[model samples]
Target chain A: MLEFLERIGWFVGLVLVQVLVLSHVHIYGYATPFLYIFFVLSLNSGIDRNILLIWAFAIGLTVDIFCNTPGMHTAAITLVAFLRQPILKGVVIKEVEEEFEPCISTMGFFPYLKYTLLCTLIFCSVVEMIDTFSFFDLKELGLKIITDTLITLVCIFCVEAVFRRDKSEERF
Target chain B: MRNLLDFLIKYKHWLLFIFLEVISFVLLFRFNGYQGSVFFTSANVVTGKVYQMTNNLTGYFHLKTINSDLVQHNAELSIQLEHLKEAYKKLTADTTVIEQMKQEALMDCRLIKANVINNSTIHANNFITIDKGEADGVQKEMGVVSGSGIVGIVYQTSAHYAVIIPVLNSKSSISCKIRRSDYFGFLKWEGGSPEFAYIKDMPRHSIFEVGDTIVTSGHSAIFPSGVLVGTVDDVGDSNDGLSYSIRVKLFTDFARLNEVRVIERSNIEEQLELEESVVNKER
Candidate 1:
């Protein structure tokens, strides 16, 4: 359970990196790269679900605080966390039923990549939708999600290629 | 009941997640009620200090430019002084008349030097940041001006920095009047262009032409009379020979804005006293 707290530490560190470092990097115009979701997706397999939802809100609130968009991050991260059960069901093929976090350990390389990609996409899309639906123009709304999700996908690919290689080899 | 309680405990994080998300969403869609909830504005103390550090690091490279700006300002002052001297030489013959005119026309004011650090010209409600802040005696609602013309009014002040809503922002308007004809109107930025703005509320009877000099009407406490604003460019608020909107070419090139002088009105209290008396008598 203390390891659950440790996972949160990783999330905070990644969010700091997102706000401090990646927030400055603009591929063209869009800045936010959706790096914090790595925390939610990479929780321990034995992690509790209710706590996961709270974690989702914390991550989103943290982002909204830094970005000045109050409710957008909270809504998006919560939506992703709420849908994790079904999303995990769709991705995980193993028959094992022990409650665990959806991570690269239980779900293999291809399956994990697909899962992260879907979660990142859905989270980014949900956030962008909530963010721009108020006053942001349609063009801005569309571009925001597309670029954010694209950047997130690229970051997830890089993170996995670098971090999950040993685990994948051990599984194979 | 015991089994239901255990099941509810198992799903607590999910409920918490929904609760937190709802809280965040409520804040996101809310705009009107939340006026001071700007925790992310660069004007925040920690973030402002960070930017100040960055500005200090970058400020070293621009010393030469700042110095030249000071020198140019001095040169203009010297030229105006010479003009005043010449006018004095001619008017000394009628010293009594000139003295009376000067007493009625001249107002005492001082200028505080400041440098621009941040500016947002693209937003409809544009804002500019100045290096001078509350620590340097800058208070809210002080009039800001450039060498060329009136810039805007001070909106917010931090310890070491102040933010101004310039004439180019839709959220602000400056009272201006025609110099030759004494027609008064409110000048405003329409949220489209920086170099241009419109003067509203002028009656159709007001005669205006291109190249007419515009100045502050001195009707508002923020700006004193005779400060340059801009020149009349075009009239557009034509409805049915009732009212005409006049377009003004702003004197300050907001895009090229760098140095500014914050006008510190010394007699503000006394002026406010006189104004309040008038209002009290009226009431």
Candidate 2:
């Protein structure tokens, strides 16, 4: 129950930050870091797939509602959620079969980095493609995808580092 | 039946994923029809309130710049007012022209003041949310303009908030013309930069320079004739090499947009009805 409440808190807090602060930050003219996807990316790997999908849908829809893009975020985040299990399995080598959240502490730095990078890239590409909804200008589309992915990667890593330090202190 | 139920349970996650994606696409493609439903938009009460509070905080930071802009505008307006006063004195002897001026004034539109609560420019279809809405007499198709120049037309409105489809959107096509040459075209945004847009379908023979001013043609009832839009920045040919596509540097900076005026044309309904009646008669 406590874990559920913690998850809910992170959900709301991330959405608020994304809507109020990060959504307005358009670096240059192309990149806007979608930090809210971090919630979906950080969900425990052992959770029920259906529940995970629902959680992803909820966060994505909340963001879409605020940003005025009806389904762009929802679709992208749901896809990320669906692929999260496979991505974790592919990136992280499990020493023991146990339920754990995917983060730097449990998965180690390099694997977690790979996991975050892959998920962020997928999420950014999907969202940007849906936002554009056209292949007319592949150059602009690729630029947006690459820039958005890189920026979001950097932000996700920064956030992960902060959270990792907090968790380590709590453990100590 | 047992096998089908077992299969459903087996691949339920895949089915759910497909179902949710399908719902998202439906909501996205059908968004045009759903504009009237404000629940999913920034104009909704909850989002509007949040954005309003955020704007209140951020708005303070923009005051210095806004004040300077207002001061410069005031100086220009006073100079133009002086010129207009001199012209009025010279034209006082012509009663017929004065009557015509009165008639033109009668056709002029009124403006409702509003502040920008939420705005986005990075999206392909950019939208801006303002504090005023239906209760403030803001309606769909009403032209929105900042102090500098044209902003956009109101796309949807709730009781206390409205969303504007700014010129940066790919779907936004406003009638604009070259100021000096009077050559007109449909202004379009190909969705890269917010600072510039393309005016397509201008005739090849239309004479316009790089720095020529572009203004609303007022072919549509939304914006009045001669409202400032932008200045021509570059010129090129259309895809078929038949018409000219001139690039325009939009005057209203969407990034720093804070306050705006929604132009309420007094005779818009009457004009629309008249035009519809003519179309119906022909049909």
For this target, which candidate reaches the highest TM-score against the unseen true structure?
A: 2
Candidate 1 CA-lDDT value: 0.74
Docking class of 1: acceptable
Global lDDT of each candidate? 0.74, 0.89
Worst 10 residues of 1 chain B by lDDT: B31-40
Residue pairs with clashing backbones, model 1 = A45-A100, A45-A101, A50-B13, A50-B14, A51-B13, A71-B24, B237-B245
Interface RMSD of each: 4.8, 1.3
- All-Cα superposition RMSD per candidate: 6.3, 1.9
User: How well is each residue in A53-118 modelled by candidate 1, as lDDT tens digits?
Assistant: 878778777765544455667788888887776777788887767775455655666887778878
At residue B242, candidate 2 shows an lDDT of 95
Off by over 4 Å in 2: B32-36, B93-103, B106-108
lDDT of 2: 0.89
Best by lDDT: 2
- DockQ for every prediction shown: 0.31, 0.78
TM-score of 1: 0.63
Question: Which pairs of residues collide in candidate 2?
Answer: none
True interface contacts retained by model 1: 0.50
TM-score of each: 0.63, 0.95
